[model samples]
Target: MSSDVIVIGGGIAGLATAHELIRSGASVTILERSRCGLEASWAGAGILSPLLPWDYPQSVARLAQLSNSLFPEFIEALTTETGIDPEYQASGMLVLPELLPESSGDAKGLRQDARNQMAEDWCGRNAFPMTRVRSREIARALARDQEAFWLPGVCQVRNPRLLQALIRAVNLAGGKIVEHTAVAGLRVERGRTQSISTSQGDEYSADHYIVAAGPWSRQLLGEHALKLDIWPVRGQILLFKAQPGLLDTILLQEWDYFYLIPRHDGHILAGSTLEEAGFDKSPTTEARQILLAKAHALVPALTEETVSGHWAGLRPGSPANIPVIDRHPSISNLYLNSGHYRYGVTMAPGSARLLSNIILDKPQPVDVTPYQWPR
Candidate 1:
């Protein structure tokens, strides 16, 4: 079918973009190779914060914070329209103190000495409410003997539920979604994308084209190759049946580079392993065990719970960890909203808004300079 805009990929980025475009009176069509929202968008744990901001670029942290601010109103409108609960919760995050070094050869003393020295270096570099605590203090807090330090602003959404809500919103908004339809190549004429050919040998054309194919964006762009350095970083998460009163807030073990998210349905989602395995979505037993051990070490109650599930997804990673959201330099009618990596779900609404502004020639809510089309 012909339309004003053809969006490739039906994950969160594509759906949100289509929703925004349609809301602005653009007739949009989404082409999904498989089921919409069943890939990275669905597999995501849905943490809305750039929890480890100290490790990311300023652009990423800014975008995440902006998106996090936009979520409340977004989810409210979505639930009102689709009657699906996005499960947006503002449950803060807790950073447990690391254990003391083992006393083998004065290691504990040496480690404390090192931290004392590093604390001086970290004084002005890090933010507030951060400190070096003894492992016994962390264990005591988990054991309810001491108070756990809280980072007040972390939040999360029910990701799979959010996708379902978006699907309903898209259909209800009069937008069309063509599932199992893979675009093999774009049909460009006179430097404009007029149509796209699917793997089934059918051609569908539109007035505008949007590529939000996540990790597969580079391949879909083909010889035209939009200078997107998007790479697939594989991450695996383990789900455990949550015990009552076990985890009240998200736990981020800063040094461990892992987190624990508590869901409304008594399930704790602990993830993830970041490996550059190149489009591989398989989960390894070793990874699972490592995650489980890490979870248990932080919250010992996890060992008593049962493993509910395990899965992996490919995050569309980039070198600078910022997404590309601009019109293609060569193809005027073509645009992109991909390479979001771990922040796709968090940045969805903001990214969609930015792309919509670009498409409609309206003023953007956030600066789109950093996410420009590659040179």
Candidate 2:
């Protein structure tokens, strides 16, 4: 049966958009190459914001803030619809500035003081709450006693649980989900999408089609993709089953682009190495050793024995971690909403809202110029 919209990709982007569409009174059918939510969306650490929100462009910040604001109601609705609670929490993030030590190692501290000043300025301008405090003041378990930035507005969610709830909620809302159906190509006629064909020689049609296929969006669109800068950047994460209370906050080392996120169930996720591996999701021993060294450096309790798992996922790497959430420049009935890089889950609801508004021809809350399909 044809659907009001055909979403090609069952990852967080696809699932979120379909759920939003269903909420907006549009029928949706999600076609996935494999099981939903088992991809990058599941493999993520579930941190609801960027490691350093101040480092990104204003466009990224707006989208993230919008999505973050919508998260409470989003999680509530999902929990009300499904029994799963996604474990949403205002678990703050602790930022450890990269320190540069002189030979004596006492005269020098806090590398990139200019960046910290920029961070402080940006936070003041944006009204984002942040405080400078000693690491030991907040996290007694930390190995060092350095000054850190305390961002209390940050949040976290069990992304796997969130995706599970989203899938269930969509199904309960009458949206269809078809797994293991890899969309091979789009059938376009007269500046609009007619149908999408799968590798199994079957076709699915919809009034409108969305290409949220994550890293594969540009390839799936082929010649139809005009100046869409999207590729796969592989990230590997390691899980350690440490005591839950050992770490109470999201610990981030901005210089190395590393973070350790704690869960309610005593599992701490240490990640991740952003490697330009190009679609290779295989975990490597070298990367694992590097991450373990970082985790051990901060919290000595996370040893090899406590290690539980290691896996990798390909992020839809974009130029500046900003996603396109607009209709195709020429194809009126087609849209694109991928290329969120590492912030897809963090930006899901806002991106979904933007795309749904574009589809429904409604007014947008934020400026839609930055996210327009590339000319």
Q: Which one wins on TM-score? A: 2
**What's the lDDT for candidate 1?**
0.83
**Candidate 2: where are CA atoms >4 Å away?**
102-111
Quantify all predictions' global Cα lDDT against the true fold.
Answer: 0.83, 0.92
Instruction: Estimate the TM-score of every prediction.
Output: 0.89, 0.97
- Cα displacement (Å) at residue 54, model 1: 2.9
Instruction: List model 1 lDDT by residue over 1-375, tens digit each.
Output: 699999999999999999889888999999999999999999998988666665577788777867877788889878999999988997766665354535553876576456544543433354423444443343332532322345556789999999999999999999999999999999888989988999999899988899999999998998776567998999999999966556667877656669888887779999998999998899999999999898786777787357889999999998778999999998889999999998999999889988988989999777788998887
Error of 2 at 231 (Å): 0.4
Cα lDDT for residue 105, candidate 1? 35
Clashes of each: 0, 0
Off by over 4 Å in 1: 100-149
Tell me the lDDT of candidate 2. 0.92
